[model samples]
Target: MTDFTEYAKALRARIDIALNQVIPETPNSQLAEAMRYSLASGGKRIRPLLLFAGYRATAGQQEHPALEIAACALEAIHAYSLIHDDLPAMDDDALRRGRPTCHLAFDEALAILAGDALQTLAFELLADTPGLTDSTRVQLIRSLSRAAGMRGMVVGQAIDLAAVDTELNITRLEHMHRCKTGALIDASVTMGALIGGASDQQLNILARYSRSLGLAFQVHDDILDVTADTATLGKQQGADLARNKPTYVSLLGLSSAQARAYELYQEALTALAELDGDTELLQRIAHYVIERRH
Candidate 1:
């Protein structure tokens, strides 16, 4: 049997090493300590794996120096988002990845600074990472900035903050999630494709595939929030419900949310069908996204 878990584990090991290289552990700087705390706090490393999968699928298994840096940048941004999201002003999450959140472990001010530093560091890595043409670097920077900035995650967060206790239709909820979660997910794939020198046609196809996959990822998260335990989830289960956030399971019910996830998984697969490359890893990743327990 093909063990994607083994592949994922090896890849995550490599990713962690590269990430450590990007931000060395500093005993002198408390801010750096806080930053390292969350960055090293293990999660699934899903975005970096997706980025690598997109690159390998499009550009074969050839190595690129910038690929590692890009992966680190994406993970850094993800880590930063989590730090901010756990702040008292945001989701107020006290636990993450089975450890106290940044704010709880460190002072809120330090946590805020750590998130800011990570966010800027992500752009710095993109802007300066070697092995890519200036044009390619600019493209990567633009793609990441848009996905992480107001046009993407920030706006989605704003919408989410305003949406507490309010009812939303399926379309609105999907849009919110697309911006909040899907944009960066799509960027992970698109940026990898760009690094792999994907053609316009390939880019478009992958965009379609990523869009569906991103939504499926979020839908599954909603389902997990309702059904999973805090210990299993590495965070407070039902946090969304406690905050009165409208999730897929809240609006569509548990069974319907599960069905929606399956539907999006199929859509992601269908989009991948048009791509010509070694997409077996990508296909497996799409399946894993919806099927992961945490």
Candidate 2:
């Protein structure tokens, strides 16, 4: 049995290094600093870890350029989304990862530009990866674009903004999350599988696993919003309630939301079990998703 804590630590370290290396050197010092500020702001790095775990699940061991590029690219996308999500027009958050958000650390204009640069940089990294075939690169770019674009995260955000103080059922909530959070999460694993040469059946199974884990991740996030304090969560406690946002805890209540997260965790584990290769890391990740306080 691998020590998942140690594994995650090492994985995060590697990802941090890759992200630093890939961040472009801009002539404008403020732009560079703002970009680094948000990208380096510490978090769980779950998206990149999922990419690595998906690769490992497919028995991919040898070094390849696509792996790090894909991991860092997905992290970049995640970071950019957070930056934009914290803007006044969006979630209007002040804190992230226990620190001031990019907009607060810098100005609103710099934060917006930083997010824009990071989003474009993600695709640039994928397009410029050295070892992948053109077809693979195209697939990776197309997949990520869709996940980050209007069809996925953007649409989810639009729906979320529209849903504020409005009635929402579990199904609609799930659909929103599936686009907002789940799309990138699904892309992380699916891109890893593509890089690792996964068969159609393997891709399907991993998709199921990632989907379950993604929703579980959001469910636990909602749970933590009500149960955990700001220091523990690294963000405002009860922000959802304050904003009157729809969340699992809001719709299903704390107990049912917690139970639903557990159920999704089981579904993720079952999906991982269908994979032929080692899935211990992914299973651990599923548990981490529901169990993490922040």
Candidate 3:
């Protein structure tokens, strides 16, 4: 079995290759340039890797070509969201992953176009994944649409925008993170499980695991935004405070947030225990996610 670190490295490489292949720079194609610019901006590819890991935990990543493509689609959708989230009308950040945000790197109009194109391209890629049967392709598209659309990531983003001026307590904060972040993270695992042909029962358990991990991931992120340095995080720390956005830290305080993250992590691992998982790898990943500086 591959060590978690090695697997993560390999997954990152694969994500980069897939992004490069799908996002092209063609002559006279403004749309293409936008796609390339946004995609090439580069982040950790965590969403795609999560999808791949879930895929592997059920059936290996190569079991279905559609799974790989669909996982990449999730990352594209994720990336597009980040691009728009950083716009002047959105988070208005100048830096992302330690580089200029898409709007900062390119003109605002082009950045908008880039984000739009990527959103559509995510679905297009899912629909046309090379090796999936027609039914599976359709299922993948439907799942992603549900997760990335209004009921999911979009709704969360809207709530986040609204909550900027308004202070949210723990309940509202959890709701926002559930929609904003957890939806896609849940989808990442769900899509992978379905594509890997997991039993319905197995999928159910995995969904529960993903749901917990997703929130934990966000809590860890919220903490890191305050504690980690800019270099490690690849973005400015305290941007949440700067924007006056309500966060776990702001709502529950750092110690409480940290405790909550740990609680969620334990719940996630406990859910995994019911399944026949390769425990060490998942455990290592669990440790890595919470402990990561970035």
Query: Which is the better candidate, 1 or 3, if ranked by lDDT?
Result: 1
Q: Mind giving the per-residue lDDT tens digits that candidate 1 earns over 67-150?
A: 889999999999999999899999999999999999999899999989998999999999988888999999899999999989
Give residue 70's lDDT in candidate 2 (0 to 100): 93
Q: What is the lDDT of residue 160 in candidate 3?
A: 94
lDDT of 3 by residue, 1-294 (tens): 677778877878877778878874556487676677678666666777666667767775355677668866887898889889999998899888888888877778888888888888899888777866788778778878888889889999999999987978788888888889999988887787777777878788888888888899999999999999888888888999898899999889999999999999998889888876444545566677788889
Candidate 1 lands at a TM-score of 0.97
Q: Against the true structure, candidate 2 has what lDDT? A: 0.90
How much does candidate 3 score in TM-score?
0.94
- In candidate 3, which residue ranges exceed 4 Å CA deviation? 24-27, 60-62, 277-281
lDDT of each: 0.92, 0.90, 0.81
Candidate 2: minimum summed lDDT over ten consecutive residues — where?
59-68
lDDT of 3 at 184: 92
Query: Could you report the Cα RMSD, in angstroms, for every candidate shown?
Result: 1.3, 1.0, 1.8
- Candidate 2 residue lDDT tens string, 1-294: 458999899888988887888777778989989998898777899988888888888855665667888998998899999999999989999999899999999999999999999999999999988888899899899989999999889999999999999989999999999999999999998898888888999999999999999899889989999999999988899998999999999899899999999999999998987899878878888988988878
Predicted structure 3: clash tally: 1
